[model samples]
Structure formats: structure tokens, C-alpha cells
Target: MNNHSMTRRLLIGLMTSITLIWLIATVMGLSVMEEEYDETFDSSLQETAERLVPLVVDDLFRKEEIVAPQQLQAARPDEEGEYLTYQVRDKTGKVLIHSHDAPPTPFPAPLQGGFWSDDTHRYYTATGVSNTIFVQVADAFANRREALSETGLALFLPIFALLPLGLALSWVITRRALAPVDDLGLEIEAKDSGNMELLKTDALPLELLPIAGSVNVLLQRLRNALEAEREFTANSAHELRTPIAGALAQTQLLINELGQGPGKRRAGQIETSLVKLNHLAEKLLQLSRAQAGVGVSEKPVDLIPVLRVLIDEFHHSGQDEDRLICRCAPNARLHGHYNADAFAIALRNLIENALIHGDPDAPVEVSLKADGSISVVNGGPVYTPDELAKLTGRFQRGHTTATGSGLGLSIATRFLEQMHATLTLASPASGRDDGFEAVVRFPHQD
Candidate 1:
């Protein structure tokens, strides 16, 4: 099956749009979160510096004198390094006091009151005691980056889990929405010459109602046209049969009366022409009936007896019994819900065609297979693909010089189709180098 189904396409398109939207929203949210983190960290940095300025000044005033930078130990031993480090310095930038995690050096920030930053940390400096004391608080860049990275990952994990769920739900919804379209297609496909019932559109969506209406109109028109054609052909053949038969009988009597003269020969020719006309008219009647859908039945019918009867009729109708052969597989069953008369008509045509067109020196072979298919093979000149294709058309003789109306195959094909059986033609009959073969395959029953 093709992977380009509409359901699959819709599902992919919808899911792709949804996933892209989600990703775009996530990116926007992460950007905003990063901006907010910057402001919050900066505010904390400034607040810590200002708040510690007064405390550092008071502690230094009680020191009496400052010898070296003092590292202020926490109340308890701190295992993790401090996220915020600070240093208290003088106007000349000499460090006087610092937090536990602060480096034993003056901070890189200038000894003034404002915000500044370097590669590793953001710094905020606060001046107190008439600009004599300076306090700077440092916030690590890595800490802010870690917080943003964790937050971005938290926002991304849901997308992976939700995308598949979203696609599955979309699939169910899509299939349900397109169900009516599928049903409509199947209904249209089922219509044929034998079944032209109107489409049922009661359950169809509003969008599909117009399509169904158009199809119904088309089917109605076709049904009417076919009915008219079949009626005309049938009536013409029925009306011609009686007159043609009387004329042919009179011609035969006249040929007998004008014995051994040029008139007799001319009468013979007329007789032959009359016989051909009668055959043509009979074929037309059969064709009309086939077109009228006379091949379908409502119950299983045993078709093997029909085949045997046709063979017997051919044997009694001046065909050489020795030149016709029949075979059947052991325990083969030929049962199908098709009209027996129609099957007989199609099979007889195949047999007659084979006898008339086949090589006079070779025999015609008929066989019924174990699977219920019937094959008719006769030794003859092999036909090309193009020639075989045209042989089934009405009035198409395909290079044969034989006497025939050329409607045999056409009628057979039409009747078989109405019966839901298929007739396949092939040259170079199975197991033979040069011949033609026709096979009738019935649909398998459950």
C-alpha cells in the first residue's frame, strides 16, 4: 500500500504544526525566564551590598586598627561554597573584611558605589562612612546559567512526551472524520450495469452530499441509455427472426427446384447468405439479453451439468466427436450463483469459436479444474497481444477469414461480467507452443 494516504498526510501535517508551535512557545518562554533571572539576581546583588555596608562600617570602627584582610567565618562550617561572595575595602581599594568564601584579595570592582561585572561574576559596590568604606557583593555567572539550564530542560521534557500522544489522538480524529468519504467511494465503486441503485446519502457529511448527488445522476443516465439500447436490439432481433427463417426455408426449396443449373448455384449462394443472416440475428438476441443483465442469480447453481449439456449438443450438431475432448479434475465442483442459461450461452460461444477458428487437423480441448475454473484450448496460429485485445470487441474479426458474426466474444464477455466472473484470453495455450486459450474464472465463495 502507498504511504501517501490522506489520513497519514493529515496526521503528519497537524502534528508537525502543533510540535512547531510548542517549540516556538517554549523558546519564547525560556527567553523571558532568562531575562527575569538576570533582573532578580542583579537586585539580590545590589541589596546584599547595600545592607552589608553599614554592618561592615560598624564592625571596622570597633576594630580600633586594621592590619590585614579578615575572613569572616560562618557561624557553622560551610561545606558548599557560597553563591554570593563579598569584600569590604577602604577608599584606596585595600580589603579590610570579607565573607568566608571570598578570595583573600581586593575585589576587581572599583572602590565606588555602583554596579559592575567581570568574566566570572556580577558585582555591586556600596560606599559608606563618607566614602571611606567600600563593600562589594559578587554573584557567580555559573550559578545564574545553571538555574536557566535546569529551567529550559524542565520546559523541553513535556514536548517529547506530549507529541506522540497528540499524534495518536489526531489519527483517531482524522479517521473518524474521513470515514464517510471512504464509505461513499466504496458505494460508487460497487455500482455497475447489473446494479445501478441510487447512492444512499442520508449519513453523508454536507461536503460530500454534492458529490453523491452528481454520481447518482450519472448512474441514472447510464442506466436509461443501456436500457434503451438493449430494448431496441432485442425488439429488432425478435421481429426479424420469423421473416428471416421463412425466407431461408423458401430459398432452400427454390434451390432444390432449380437443380443442376446456374439458377441453382445462385440459389445456393442465397441460402448461404440467409443462413449467415439468421445466425447474426440469433447472436444479436443473445447479446441483447446479456446486456440486459441476465447472468446474475440469487442462489448457488451447479454449472458442471450445463457444460456437459453443451458438449453433447455440439457432438450432435455435426461437429466431429473425435475432434472435441473434455476433461474434469477428480471431485471438482463447479457451483456459483449465476444464471445457467447465461453460462451456457458464454460457454457455447467459446466452444463454437474454437471449432470454427482452430486448425482443422487439431482437436479442441475443454477442461474443468479443481478450483471450478473452465478452460477452452484449441490448436491454432498464435495471436499477438494487440490482436487478442481486439478479438473481444463487437464486429472485430482480427485477421480471421472464418465465417462468423464476431459478436460471440463480446456477448460472452458481457454476460460473464454480469455474473461477476472473469473471462481471460491468452495465446500459446498452456503447455502448447502455438494455440489460443480462454478461461472462465468464477469468484470464490466463502
Candidate 2:
């Protein structure tokens, strides 16, 4: 369903398959090796039995012959190696001759001629030396187990060595095979709302091409939908502005024609409504321009002088009732697309909002530091965290029903965003202090 799910499933499937295949191969190889070892050991046992038959038969017939058991035991085996023991017995099962170091356990009951017992520690091959004498050769079970264990180790050693190599190879293959997915993620990350274009699928493998194509198609559809919505809002706002302007003009004309009365009061109400509508229209225009990424012209600009000029202008602009305190360090400059007009507009909006909402008699302090940072602090009822979050939204008013339009903070925020700057709002450190501070940071000019 999602890329994470798909990737997880693919990785699990590959790991499972590799594990199963490796296990099967290891098991099969071990089994073959075990079988070969069993066959070779059995063959050697049979060959040893055959070679010992003559010596055992001769010794059984010559019952009185003085044969040295130690000399026979010391004799080295020829082509057929032997680790064996023998016993010659009468028809009544009485031992006539026996090899040294034979087990105390009784040999298996005699068969027709020869028989092997895997559970017992013996392979009995009986040969009649005469009508009354029979000879038997036997080997031990310990030898078989030893051989099998050795063979198992031989088979398992390579597999143990290969496991690390397999894991390493899996890692390499996984990284290489999933490289396209990583690239796709990077490509998506490089995009933003302003540049939501369809991604190309040409570089993807055949197996992944369809997925990439679908993603690109979805991106295209989303881009188209967003563009259509923006166009509709912009066009509708433009169309309504003219009609609202005309109605306001007519109302003004009527107000002029009729002297002060109930008619003048009604006209005043209409004019107030027109002013609110105009404010809304202006906010809409500002929001549209902000979304369109307008009003940026890159150049080095002295921020200290800009802050001083704005404070001076605000002090002169119909706010003599309020004290404006300005503090700025000398020669602080920032590197960015600096639109002097936009900067002035944004700064004025912040200062005006502070002056209106803050205490009229108290100072509205504006401070600019040498690090290209500016802070505007005002004594006012601080907004809650949620309220502060919404302060940058269009048409959002603060706690009080101030007569001014609510687009001031939103416009400043948008302008700062376009200038590659950051704006932060915080309450005074006492936690419940009835004052708010707005800080703006501009990158230092190179």
C-alpha cells in the first residue's frame, strides 16, 4: 500500500528466500557427504574382513600350531586397511582362538554365513575352516561414529565460512537495488509547494517504472488541482473587488447628497461595511501575492539604518500619543533579496499593531542588535500558544476587538518568509506577564 510497507515486504521476502536456499543447500551437501563417508567406511570394513579370512581360517584348522598373537597383530595391513578383531569357534560356540583386545560383549548370534548388526559393535562375517570350526571377523561401532563426525565437520566448515560472505553480499545487493528509491526520496524532498512538478521515471528499472510513472501522474494531478484552486480564488477576488468598490462609491455619493440625519447614519453604516470589505479584499490580494512568491530582490542592505528609518517614520505617523523607543547598533547589514518598500510595510504593520494593542502611555520598544536580529516588544495582553500560532493566519484578530484590520501580522509574516527570514513570537519570561515580544532574524551579509 505504502512505500514503507512495500519495501519491508520486499526485504523480508528476499531474506527468507535466501535463508531457505542456503539451508537446503547446506543440508543437501551434508547429506551427500555423510552418505559418501558411510559407503567408504563400509567398503573398507568389508575389504578388511576378506583379507583376514585366510589367516583366521588357517589358524582355526591348525589347532595345535603355536602362533604368536602379538606377531600377527603387529603385521601392517596392505591395500585394505583394517581395524578389526577375529574369533575362531567350534560348532558348540566354544572359543578356540581369539584376537587380543576384543570387547567383552558377546558377538551377535551366528547367521547363515555373514550378517552385520549396526546396533551392536560388530560386523560378523563367518567362514567355515572345516565342518566343525568357523571363523568370524568383527569391527567396532566407535570407528563409524568417529568417521561420520569428521565427515560432518568437513561438510559444515565451508557453510560456516560462507554465511558472513552471504550476509555481506546481501547488504551490497540491497543497497544497490534500493538506490532508485533513495533517489526518488531525495527528488521529492527537493520539491516544495511552489514547485510541485511531475517527477521523471526514465531512470527507473523496468520493474519499478510503473510505480514511478503513477507517482508522477499523481503529482501532476495535484499540481493541476492546486493551480486551479488558486486561479479561482484570485479571479473571484478580482471580480468582487470592482463591484464592492462601485457600491462603496455610490454610498459615498449618497452620503454627500443627503445632509446629516437617519439617512447619514445609515450611509455611515454602509461606509463601515465597505471599509471592512476593502480590508478583506486587500488581505486577499496580499495573501495571493505571498503565495505567488512575489516581492523579493536580492541585494546587500544595511538593517540598522532600515530599523532606525522605520522607527522614525512610525513615531511621526499619527502616533504621538504613544512613546516609541528605538535602539539599534551601528552598521548591521544582511545579505538577501531586500525590497525596501516591502520591509518598510512589514515593519510599520508590526509597530502599528504593537502601538494599538499595547499600553498607550508605556513605551513600544523596538531593538535591533549587531547580529542582524531585531525585536519589537510591547506591553499588552500576551496571546496563548494556540492564539500565537494562528496570529500569522489571514484575517486573524488578537484577543481584543480592535478597529484595525487583522491582516497586519499575516502580511509581515509572509513578507519575512519571502525574504528568507524567520519570525518568532514569545511571551515575557515571567510566564504570565502581560507583554509579547516579536523577534525577526536576518542572515548576516557576506
Candidate 3:
């Protein structure tokens, strides 16, 4: 999960645990306070009853005369003062003396010592005097309930108040703890392919330092690999250029020395080889430039004029004029600056490839549209999906074209990439009769 999600889950878990603990503590505290209050009230009631038993023994045992109403009323004050109710009964269970407010049911049969009501709302105690006079005391639970409620409130109120404070503290603590991660993210955001370097390990937590170190190691390795590849390409191109140039110079000298005949034919062969070598060298340079991410700043450029120039150049170069065609969309313009040399090289390679591999009688058609794209269609056997996919790969030539240099499409692909464009090769949408088409799409600016 993301850091934010993980933090949220942790905060929720902590809060839940805290809430549960608070609830349990509150409940337990209330229970204990309630029990203590009930115990104190019950003890007071029992003591009052015990003390009254001795005084009321004679009155309770005297069955011949009833207790005077005034005497009963005088004892009622003690019962009321102690929050207790009392009743004095004979062996037959008839009440002889009772508090003024005593209930008709005689306070639910008390035990020999004491007993509690089923609902715990009252406590009752009794003492038997000579098995004839029994005195009972009952204490109401109003004060105990009030005390328990107050205790519960005391325990619960702080917890409720602290919940939001706890949440804010949790957020603050989490953010502080994760500060290194946020810093690392910002550092990574500032990085690009051109600046592949080891990230600094300082300021990272001990547990995460190893991860940051590993990432830095990976970046270092990648930088080394790219540097090695670039060096190799540069060295190989330098080494090959010297020999190719020497061979071309020697071939020109030999052509001058031998006039016509078999010598001339051999010289022509050498010239063809030189041309292929030059093409290969140029392609290598293009590939290297593409790998280095070369691109030009974009600006408005007119496509119609560019296409016309390319067409005129092709005609002037002795390419069959009748076999070449241009279909320009009227007033077609594109909003991107391209390296004119690179653009011409890419277009020439595509057209030359089509001319050499395509059916000689069929016209090679080039088209440009206002949508910042160009297409070159040639008449030839259409390639399958697999072949089309490999068409732009280095030194890849179709099965039918054995005499041709396989670098043509690769050079075009590299040039397009360097120009910040895309190249696609596919069979003509009009079916096999129109053969294959190579499409290039340029990144345009407004």
C-alpha cells in the first residue's frame, strides 16, 4: 500500500485500541465505585438496624400491646437520616413497629445477615431478637447510582476530549517520521536520464538507508553501461572510417590507372562497395545520435515547400522522373523545426530503399499532409506483421531483397527518432495491389 494508506490504517488501529481501552477502564471504574458506594450504604444500614434492634426488642416482643404511633414516628427520623427504612416483626411475621414510609410488602424477606434486591436498587439487613422480635433495615440505591454515574462521566469525559488531540498528534508524528521518504521522492523527481547518479544516503532512516543505497548502486551501473555503449560506438566508427576512406581513395586511383574493359568493371564493383560502406557509416552515426536523444527546438515549417524541394532533388539526381510522384495536400504546413540535413537523409534513404526493392515499373509515391505526418508508398510484396516489426531494426532486410543494404530502414528509423518523431511500416490500407507504406509522424508545436 501507499504511505498515506498505510498511515491511515495505523492511525485507525491505534485510535480503536485507545477507544476500547478507555471504554473498558470507564466501565470498570464505574463498576468499582458503584460497588464501594453500595457497600458503604449497606454497612450504614446494617449498623443502624443492629443498634435499633436492642432498643426495639421489648416493643417488638410485646404482642399484647401495639407500639404507640408517636414512638414509631420518633424512630422514623433515624431511618430517614440514614436513608434507610425499618420494620419490626413478631415470630408470626406481623409488623409491630415500622417506619412511617415502610412499604406494604415488608421489604422483601431479608437474610439472617443481609441481602440485596434483585435489581440492586436496595440493600436489606435483619437481626432476630430471641427468635420473637425481628428488625429489618433497607437502604435505597439512589446515592450509589448517582456516584457511579459521576464516576463514569469522570472517566469518559477526558477520553472524548483527547480523541481529536490524539488524531492530530498521530498525523504530526507520522509526517515527521516519514519526512525522509518525502525528501527522497523530491530528489527522485529532480532526476532525469541525463543525471543518473547515486542518491545521497545521509538523512535516511537506518532501516531505509540500505534501500536508498541499492537504488544508487543500480543507477551507477546503468550510467556505466550507457557510457560503455557510447564509447564503443564512437571507437568503432572512428576505426572503420579510416579504412573505408582509404579503400575509396585507392579504388578511385585504380579507376584512373585502368581505362575501360575488365579493369573498369572491377573499379565499378569497388565503387559500389564504397557506396555501401559510406551508407553503413552514415547509418552508424545516425544510430548513435538517436541513442543520445538528439532533438531540435520546434518552430513552424512549411511542408509543401519541403516536399517540392525533395522531389526536385530526386529528379535532378537522375532517379527515374516518371517513376517518382509527389501528392502534396494544398497549403500543407507543419509546426516543428527539423534538422534539414537529417530530414533529407531520412527521406532519401526511404525513397532509395523503395526504388531498389520495389517493382521497377511501379511508381514510388510520397505524400505530405497538414497533420504533421508524411508517408512513402512503394509497390512491392507486403511484409507480414513479424517482418514489419523487424523492418526498422539494425541490418534487417526483407527476405526478397538480398542485394540491398539492410541499413536503409534502420537509418530512417534512427533519424526519425532523433527528430523526436515516430516511424511505422505497414502494408497499404488499399490492399496488396498498393504494396507497403512507411509512415513518419513528427511531434509538432502550436
- Model 1 residue 222 lDDT score: 95
**TM match of model 2 to true structure:** 0.78
Tens digit of lDDT per residue, candidate 1, span 147-187?
99999889888889988888888988999999999999999
Q: Give residue 11's error in model 3 in angstroms.
A: 7.7
Better of 1 and 3 by lDDT: 1
Taken over the whole model, the C-alpha lDDT of each candidate is 0.89, 0.70, 0.73
**TM-score for predicted model 3 compared with the true structure:** 0.62
Between prediction 2 and prediction 3, the one with superior lDDT is 3
Score candidate 1 by lDDT.
Answer: 0.89
Number of the top candidate by TM-score? 1
Kindly report which residue stretches of model 2 are placed more than 4 angstroms away from their true locations once superposed: 1-13, 57-71, 74-83, 88-100, 104-106, 109-112, 126-135, 154-165, 232-264, 295-316, 319-323, 337-349, 411-420, 429-432, 442-446
Please provide, for model 3 over 1-446, each residue's C-alpha lDDT reduced to its tens digit, 9 standing for 90 to 100: 64557678878998899899889887887777777877787778778878888788765455576743322755443454535677776666666677766654555665455666756346555666556667777766675666678778878889889999999999899878877888887877765444576788876899778878888887888878877887787678777888888999889888889987997898989888887777677667665655554444466454456567888988888867778888877656655667665677788888888777887878888888767688888887867898889988877888564366587888778767767789888875245555878888887634
Candidate 2 overall Cα lDDT vs. reference? Answer: 0.70
Candidate 2 lowest-lDDT run of ten: 66-75
Q: How much is 221 displaced in model 1, in angstroms?
A: 2.1
* Backbone steric clashes in candidate 3, count: 0
